[model samples]
Target: MRTGRTAHLLFLADATSVHTQRWVGAMAARGWRCTVVSRLPHEVPGAEVIALGTGEGNAQWLAAAPRVRSLAHRLRPDVVHGHYITSYGFWAAACGVQPLVLTGWGSDILVSPRESRLVRLLTGWTLRRARLITADSRDMLTEIATYAPRARLEQVYWGADTDKFHPVAKAPWPFRIVSLRAWEPNYHIDVIVEAVALLRQAEPGAAIELHLLGGGSMEAPLRSLVRARGLEPFVHFHGKVDEDRMAALVNQASVSVSVPASDATSVSLLESMASGLPVVVSDLPANRQWVDAAGGFVVPAGQPAPLADALKALLREPRLAEQMGRRNRATVERQASRRSQMDRMDVLYRQVLGWTP
Candidate 1:
């Protein structure tokens, strides 16, 4: 594969999403003339943006098809890529875009299709329309297979920026546990709060703190749980922070925890690994694809006791935590660094375009 090849890519996605922004930026940097056609327009340098401005609903998507078709005809991009198969993928299919590429973002494939018969059938139809489909994890790829076996599937991770997330000079601080997972229903962040309380009970007078890094529908209830457990002093709710602050927080933290009920390859977990923090992740197949005993402990999800025990062990054994962090850094450098993954993605793009390898 070579760099600096001229290519045009039209992307359909929720431009407001950070993931979308990151993907667009990376793709643009690789010398692609990227144009983002999104419902909600977001600013990303080096790429053209087109806002659909259509209000949400099935009716809106149907209405927007002609507009999308007109735009596609005008641009005539080499490839049409859509993120989140549920919405963008369907839109791309509806617009009759050729050389279509669809990327499934976790719940869109795992949860949304099960909501209704129409959605399941429509999702399968959309999958059949795509020339290539991508998933962030092998588990997700398998799920996508159940819907579209004939659709070409590739497991491509949205990996972490290792240079920005690399280990920093460690300063003496309280044993800090950081979770970048959203405080949402499936994420079970409240379970982490409960785990903290259990840790307090198990270790009589351990100096520890928990940093909840994202906000969601479960924020109020999780805060209430923290208060009820009298964990105000030890738990901190940091709604959300920018990328720099996120890197700093992860670098400072002694351990990271991510126990989502279902997930793909989480950028949070990869960032923690690149930042040289020991992780305690859920034993979900998606998470297991990246995290193992070598990087961190894989505890059973939704179980506070086992979760706390994992956190406690990391807290108790500083050497073990440091050892695991070192291993994690090495693993990420080899497998999940942003540059390497993006290079592989570029190869995929070229392959799809039938460019000579």
Candidate 2:
């Protein structure tokens, strides 16, 4: 049993994000009291949810700030943690909440900063209020340092649950590839389709299948691209699957691909690794940390030729793919296990609260 002074946490984040739900659940399981304050209503097992009912877009957050602040005063949490620096961090800081912890989730720091001067100023100002800031990757920490130079920053991964994502035995059939990233412009899901088209010619008469497992704005256009390339029979779009079904799909595939243009350490990528599948991912600095030469091929984002080559190579050499999958499983167990990362976060909570073992 967990024995310690309980830490009451007030989390500000998007209720829709799987990252937020997972983190809150993990902390609650560890005996921390977690209350989520979100604009969107979500059900996190073991935590109390205060649905702010703030609608879509950034402007809505301004209206929701007063409610958030009022709730904070009444609750008097031991710590206030904001998941996305640009959105939740803005509100947490605006409310003048102290002992705040802010986590930068990739695009919030990388893409949002470039939106406008006001946004950049607001993000930096909020970072200043944070007692500590957390980011998923070392490269992300380097980026956060520019915005909040004096603020303490820690690299903490929102890790994949190893127990839930571990590999299951299955006899392989035709070569199958899974891309679970959303069909958004940023994730470049279209690139996966294009790469599959290129691979068809590289390995003539070879039976191959591409499983696209997400939903986004680019769905219609991605379908058009697949039809245009005459890849309708070869590709299957399984839109926005849940956890259990997604794990079943991953276990059935021989390879996985997540070549987003930019990302922090992806939970999907970690799950793919934990499932003992070799991945073909973008060569971005963040991905480079988890996917090395031993685990899989790293291709340049948006380049079909290299991605096609990587995919074709894996299909041709099944033994090589298996070896990489084994390496990936071991690597994820060592570096990205959810149990280990959550344990680390628990330590940080104690340290922040000045509670000794």
Q: Relative to the unseen true structure, what is the C-alpha lDDT of residue 269 in candidate 1, on a scale of 0 to 100?
A: 93
Off by over 4 Å in 1: 1-6, 57-59
Model 2 clash pairs are: none
Q: Write the per-residue lDDT of candidate 1 for residues 171-201, one digit (tens) a residue.
A: 5458899999998989989889999999989
Model 2 clash number: 0
lDDT of 2 by residue, 1-357 (tens): 234456698899877777888899899998889998888898887789888877766778777788889889898888899888888888887767677888999998888888878778888888888888899988889988887456678988888778778787766667889998999998888888889999998887888999999888898999999999999998999998888888889988899999999898888999999999999999898999988888999999988889999998898888999999999999989988988999999888777766645
Would you list the clashing residue pairs of candidate 1? none
Residue 52, candidate 1: C-alpha displacement in angstroms: 1.6
Going through the candidates in order, what is the number of backbone clashes in each? 0, 0
TM-score for each prediction? 0.94, 0.95
lDDT of each: 0.87, 0.87
lDDT of candidate 1 at residue 274, scale 0 to 100: 98
